[model samples]
Target: MEYVEHRMNDEAVKAAASAGLVSPLNILLLSIILYTGYSTFFAKTSYPQLPKPPPPVVFKTYNPHTLLPFNGENGAPIFFAVRGVVFDVTPGRNFYGPGGPYANFAGRDATRGLACGSFDESMLTKDLDGPLDTLADLGPDEMDALRGWEERFTEKYNIIGKFVSMKDFEELGKKE
Candidate 1:
């Protein structure tokens, strides 16, 4: 009786194996486990290392003429002046660079333009060497508008330098 029962169990096992009891999913999982174990403990592959970044550039003061070259022309960085503060607006190149809507203000004092909410060339200072705009004619509302723009610039861009007149810059150089 015992021999008959053992023979029946052996036949059942052979039938199950022939009928594809081990699924395709089980085979795939086993292959993945083997690959993972081999890669983790036996593979000699190494990942490539990334290069380090360059150092930060030192900021320099700029007068209007000196600042003119940084208007996104000839691959130059974009910079602009606002109320005597020179901001490096390179990150906003899309809006302040060449062919941009506010490109006219790049490398120039944008005080009056921003205060008046105009992007016209007429708003910029006509003479680079001339005295800065006093903004004396601006009403309270205009002044408030200018202040808002200045605040946004301060929050968004780097204050690379101060915008001074040529005369003031020369005086500063002489003092140094």
Candidate 2:
């Protein structure tokens, strides 16, 4: 009789486990589901990295007289200069075209204006004729701002060429 009773208890425990009632396997399944839910719904994830691009192919140098013609005139591509770097801003013609807010900046190297956060035409200059000391007026904060603009332009646009002074143009013309 004692042996029969022990066997009956064993059978009852096995039946409870098979019925998915309080059992080790059931507890483990619940734990897995909870963990999966927590990870999927609550865990923080980092941003994915962007792919690297190839080096840009730079075109010949450009002067303000040459760069100005691409100002969306008669379906021409719009262009702009920043800190001696020229960008084809045709893609954003509505924002940089004639009569646009930044229209004054389209044909000029407005580095000083950008650095100082001034839209004054006086700050814009295409003639980088003077010595490097011309930029001595910029403070550290202004320089930082200028660097930020250049970085943003590099990331966003295709750099075509650099701005050239009349003196440099003359020298290159003589060479060619």
Candidate topping lDDT = 1
Every model: Cα RMSD to truth = 6.0, 9.0
Reference-based TM-score of each model: 0.72, 0.61
Prediction 2 TM-score vs. true: 0.61
**Superposition error at 100 for model 2 (Å):** 1.6
lDDT of 2 by residue, 1-176 (tens): 99999999999988976887667788999999999999899999788988897556658688767776777767777777786788877677777787777777776676787889888778876354532225788899999999998998888878889887767777889999
Looking at model 2, how many pairs of residues clash?
A: 0
Clashing pairs in 1: none
Which consecutive 10 residues in model 2 have the weakest lDDT in total? Answer: 125-134
Segments in model 2 whose C-alpha atoms lie over 4 Å from true places: 1-58, 126-133
